[model samples]
Target: MTRSRKTTQPLVKICGLNTLTVVDAAVDAGADMIGFMFYARSRRAVTPDLAQALGEEVTGVTRVAIVVDATDAEIDAITATGVIDMIQVHGKEDPARVAELKARTGLPVMKALRVATKEDIREAEAFFGAADHLLFDAKAPKDMKGALPGGNGLTFDWTLLDGLKIDMPWMLSGGLTADNVAEAIRLTGAPGVDTSSGVEDKPGVKSPERIRAFLAAVKQTHLETAT
Candidate 1:
């Protein structure tokens, strides 16, 4: 299930990696993508120097830069580092901004939209041809105070995605782990899966063993589906 030459496999992404050891662990664990957070406010944020140091270790793995509602200057600065292969905008950027970034940076754009209601899910339809990848993570509840947009470790009801389909490739993130990843994929049939808080021992610390376990669970889910 890990290395499938036949069955179409899901890409596994390990986000919020800060240190070389953790980044190495993710790459060693066979993750398809490694994410580096640029939002300094988040506990998982890493300096550009740290990201470059860790990013240098990545060979076959795709390096992703995770940023918030970043301005064009910020995007320019991060993309200038020449380490990132993809840009993941985990913020309130609209479709126009996403398209602009894609035009300017020449990097594949991965837009993260927090879903709380069906309307929110439908809202991303406009970005279908505009974005390279679309991510659906749980939205910060309105009344809740100061919730980080992407890695809040919260999960929206999976049933919310029932029968949901989009022309764009998408992922199921938020509250995913080794324990429930199989169920999440079975429930939503996501083409890809991402994790940050789920594989962490704390806010930003990643566990290599956990990464392997989660990947195994996704494999298990695919097997169950193939039957």
Candidate 2:
């Protein structure tokens, strides 16, 4: 089975953004999407008001609100801000929940599936019709301390996706950085890629230089792939 791509070039989403500076940097650097963490436990989390303020002036880049098993009120508050273009459910939300969120928020949903093995990938099929897009991320070890759902910066085996078939749009994520993203795309033939902790200086701090370097690397990869 062959995987499908949404565009000729791999789409880039820089997640876990909290400041306007990084937001501006991502947009200026030609990012396809920018994410705001709405989960309180995440070090990179931001309030709906803060996300709104940071995303208000942004254009051309899709703004995504990332949540982890959010309640109805929590989702309502985030969507009420009117700053998000997409909703990324990063927890244990099943296909039913994914569809419900789309109906409730009137926004496209991107369901994040944590992959530690082939079985996890197979389970993602449940969301095929429910979600608009799917994100494959590394599942942290159960014993790992201080691990968040999606931004733990751990990478999975890209080969796990080899020959796997899917009909909907999906993204490759987890520990992707300037150093390895090109190779990741080469291996998985992923149409889109997302990075959070990979571009950070520390747990929650994003470095402008690293962000620029990462984007430049992806751009170069796209250029090479085109030729």
Number of the top-ranking candidate, with lDDT as the measure:
2
Candidate with top TM-score is: 2
Tell me the tens digit of each residue's lDDT in model 1 across 51-125. 877787767777899999888888888887888999999888889989999999999999998999988888888
Superposed model 2: Cα runs more than 4 Å off? 1-8
Summing lDDT over every window of 10 consecutive residues in candidate 1, give the lowest-scoring window: 1-10
How does each model score on TM-score?
0.92, 0.95
Cα lDDT of candidate 1 equals 0.85
Superposed by TM-score, candidate 2 places the C-alpha of residue 25 at a distance from the truth, in angstroms, of: 0.6
